[model samples]
Target: MKTVFITGSSRGLGLEFTKQYLEKGYLVIASCRTPEKAKALHDLKMQYSDTLSLIQLDVTKEKERDRAFDEINEVFDSIDILINNAGIISGDGKNLYNLGDVHKEDFMKVLEINSLAPLLMSEKFLPLLEKVTNAKIINMTSQNGSITQRTQGGKYSYCTSKAALNMITKILSNDLREKEITVLAIQPGWIQTDMGGVNAPLKPAEPISKIIELVETKEIADTGKFLTQEGKELPW
Candidate 1:
């Protein structure tokens, strides 16, 4: 079975990805900030004990990232897929998403978690990724990241963080091109999640299923593209 590593696997899209990937018979190393508190993930672990491995990983912490890397690497020789799904919407843990409303510290926190952490995780896990054939890195970005897609802007930090992530995705793609590793930034759409709000029309399952399909079928040609949940390319 192919081995995959996913960050932020406690709830929302991360949890859903863990469930589906386990069901599909993949060996999944799922990490969250608090594995003990992740009851749903625990339940899934019980159900798919053979295929799922749950670990504690606060992506922003370098020590935890390195520890998780060592632990995971000891068990699995190579990682076929790495899903950098961990991110934050608000810095102060509020709905203060607008430019004027959000504080500078909050904005920096968002950037650290959403933009910097992915790169850090990738850097730490490069050896394992390089060990695998046709390895892929999926950065969960947003359509709001697109410079051209912005019409009515308000989410300064969120938008900017994702935009930075998009750039990182491109850079990684170019750097890893010779290694034949595919790197992509994917917008999973506005779904009915905690960050997406309750009014979101799309649910977690729909977009996640589509995202998995895109991940499964992605090729070298698709690398460095900003793609929708349905695998359609979006403008940067």
Candidate 2:
């Protein structure tokens, strides 16, 4: 069976991805910082049993990342696809004045978790990933990352981190091309997750199912693109 490693699988979009992939017969390595707190994943584990395996991971922690690499090394041959599904939003970034009032520490924390850690994970696991014939690294990015669209302009931390993630995606795409791993960024649309909020247009299921389809059909030429659910490439 094909294997996938997904970060932030404790809840929201991550949980959904774990559920869907397990149903499709892929062995899923689901990682979250707090495994006991992941009630949904806990329930799914009881039902899915053998396919879904939980591991402790907090991207901000290097020790955790190394431990995860060791775990994956022991559990499977190599990951066919890796979904960097972990992300965070500034609870303070709702309006303009809110940006000024935001704590610098919180902003740095978000960047560490959202932007830098994924790069670290990619670098650390690159060797193991090299074993897969069709290796893929999917960075979960946002339309907010689009330099072309500014909109109302409040979420400074979230927006800048995702934009940086896009740049990292491009850099890795170029770097990994010769290595045979496909590095790509995807905009999962405004799905109704904890971060996306209730008013968000589509449900998590909609964008996620579409993303899986895209991953299955992902082409060599599709690298470095900021793509949307409908298969249209969004502007970087």
Candidate 3:
């Protein structure tokens, strides 16, 4: 069975990804910042005990990243897929804000979690990812990242962070091309999740299912593209 590692799997899209991948017979390593508090993830772990491995991970912390890598590497020889799904929107970016009123620390925090952590995780796990023949690194990005599609002005911190993530996806895809690891920045649409909000028209399940399909079917030739959940290529 293929092995997949997912960050932020305590809730939202990450938890859903863990559940579905386990159903598909993949050995899933689901990590969250607080595993003791993740009731939903615990429930899924109980149901899929044999295939699911739960670990505590705080994507922003380098120490935690190294520890998690050591733990996972000891048990799993290789990872066929690594999903960089952890992210955050700062309070200053939660809604429309005056440019001058946005908190500098909060903005930096958002960038650290939403942009830098994924690239760091990819770097730390590249060795394990390289062990598998058809390896992939899926960066959970947003269409808000698209420089060409920017029409609105608010959400400065969130938008710019995602844009940085888009650049990381492109660079990593280029760097890993010879290793046969396909890298993709997937826009999962505005789904009904904690991050996406309740008013979102798209549900998490449909978009996630479609995303898995794209992940499974996409060839190396399709790497480095920013794609929608529906498989449409978006403007970078």
Candidate 4:
């Protein structure tokens, strides 16, 4: 059976992805910042039983990251897919910032969480990822990352961080091109969630299911290209 490791598997899109992967019969290494505090993930662990394993990963914390790396390295020698779903948007609703008022602290934190964390995780998991016969890296990016999609730009922190993440995805695809791995930059789209908020047009599962389909497909010429959930090329 294919094994997948997903970060930020506590709630929202992460939780949903974990559920779907388990339903599809894949062994899921689901991670949350706080395994004991994540009631939902804890419950899913109980429901899925042995199919799902819960672990704590703050992503921002180096010690936690190291512990997670060591534990996964010891437990699972290979991971078929690694989903970098852990991300943050600092100024979503509160502390409204215009172009001039973009708080430095918030911007730095967003970049650290959304952009740097994934790279760190990938680096740590390289050995485990390489052990798999056909490994894939999925960077959970956003349409906001696309310069073409930026019409009304306000959330500077989120937009900049996600856009940087898009670049990182492309870079990963290029770096791993010679390797037997597929690195994809996927836009989950504007789905209703804590980040997307309610009244968003698309459902959370729509983009997620699309991601699963894209990951399983054969590698095409567009290795480092950015794409939407529907497999359409997104202008970066």
Candidate 5:
């Protein structure tokens, strides 16, 4: 079975990805900040004991990331897919991330988790990815990141971070093209997650299912593109 590593597998889209992939018989290495507190992941672990491995990872901290990498490297030969799913939206309760309300500290915090962490994870796991054929790095970005698609602005930090992630995805694709590793920035439309809110038209399951299919089928030719859940290319 192909092995996939997913960050932020404790809940939301990340948890759904873990569930679906495990159901599809893929060996899943799921990481989150607090695995012990991740009741859902632990429950899934009970069912998928042989196939699932949970690791504690903060994603932002280098020491934790290094430890997680070493732990995985010790057992697994390579990882076929890396899903950069960990992200955050920093809000100071009063501010709505509007122009005047956007604080540097909040903006930087969001950037560190949503943008920088993914790049760091990809770099740290490059060796494991390189060992496999058709390896992929899937960055979970947002349509809010699209410069051409932007009509209104409110989520300054989240939007900026995802936009930066899109650029990182493109650059990484170019750099790793010769290595034949596919990289993509995927926008998983509004869904009923904590981030997306309950009023969202779609649910996590359907979008995540489509995303899994996209990951399995997309080729090197599709690298560096910003795509919707259906695998259609989106504007940069």
Candidate 6:
């Protein structure tokens, strides 16, 4: 079975990805800030004991990232896919409202997780990815990242972070093209997750399912592109 590693697998889109991938028979290495507290992941672990492995990871910390890498390397020689799914909208006790309400520290914090962490995770796990053929790095970005798509302006922190992530995806794709590793920035659209809110037109399952299909069939030529859940290219 192909192996996949997912960050922030405790909840939201990450949790949904874990569930679907495990059901599809992939060996999943799921990481979160606290695996023990991840009731949903633990429940899945019970059902997919042999196929699932949960590790503790705070994506912002380099040492934790290193540790997770070493731990996974011990059991698996290579990973076929890496999903950079961890992200945040606001920092601890910091507001990310309109211009006057936004905090600089909060902006940096959002960028750190949504933008920097993915790049760091990709770099940290490059060795394992290199060992496999057609390896992929899937960064969970947002349509809000698209310069052409943005008409409103309140979500400064979240929007800017995802935009930075799009750039990282493009740069990584170019750098790793010779290595044959495809990198993509995918927009999940408005779904009924905590971040997406309750009135979203779609649910997590549908979009995530389409995303998995896109991931499974994407080609090297599709690398560096910003894409919707259906795999249509979006303007950066």
Q: What RMSD value applies to candidate 1?
A: 0.9
Which residue pairs does candidate 4 place in steric collision? none
Residues 1-236 of candidate 6: C-alpha lDDT, one tens digit per residue: 99999999998999999999999999999999988799999999999999999999999999999999999999999999999999887786444746888887888899999999999999999999999889999999999899888999788888899999999999999999999999999999888887777999998999999999999998787788899999999999
Candidate number with the higher lDDT (4 or 5): 5
Candidate 5 runs further than 4 Å off: 91-96
* TM-score of candidate 2 against the unseen true structure: 0.95
How accurate locally, in lDDT, is each candidate? 0.92, 0.86, 0.92, 0.84, 0.94, 0.93
TM-score of each: 0.98, 0.95, 0.97, 0.94, 0.98, 0.98
Residue 16 displacement in candidate 4 (angstroms): 0.6
* Per-residue lDDT of candidate 5, residues 113-203 (tens digit): 9999999999999999999889999999999899999999688888889999999999999999999999999999998988787899999
Q: How many clashing residue pairs appear in each of the predictions shown?
A: 0, 0, 0, 0, 0, 0
Best by lDDT: 5
lDDT of 4 by residue, 1-236 (tens): 88899999888889989988998999999999878888988787788897898888998889999999888878786898999998876734463345867887778888898998998888888888888766888888888788878999587888888899888888887787777677888888888878777988888787788788888884735567678878888889
Q: Give candidate 3 regions above 4 Å deviation.
A: 91-98
Predicted structure 1, TM vs. truth: 0.98
Candidate 4 weakest ten by summed lDDT = 89-98
Worst 10 residues of 6 by lDDT: 89-98
Give the alpha carbon lDDT tens digit for every residue of 43-132 in model 3: 988899889999999999999999999999999999999999998866444553338667777888888999999999999999999998
Cα lDDT of model 2 by residue, 58-133, tens digit: 9879899999899889978888898998998863454332456666777787788789988998998898789988
Q: Candidate 1's residue-wise lDDT over 156-211, tens digit each?
A: 99999999999999999999988888999999999888888899989998899899
Q: Can you list the residue pairs that collide in candidate 3? A: none
Q: Which is the better candidate, 3 or 6, if ranked by lDDT? A: 6
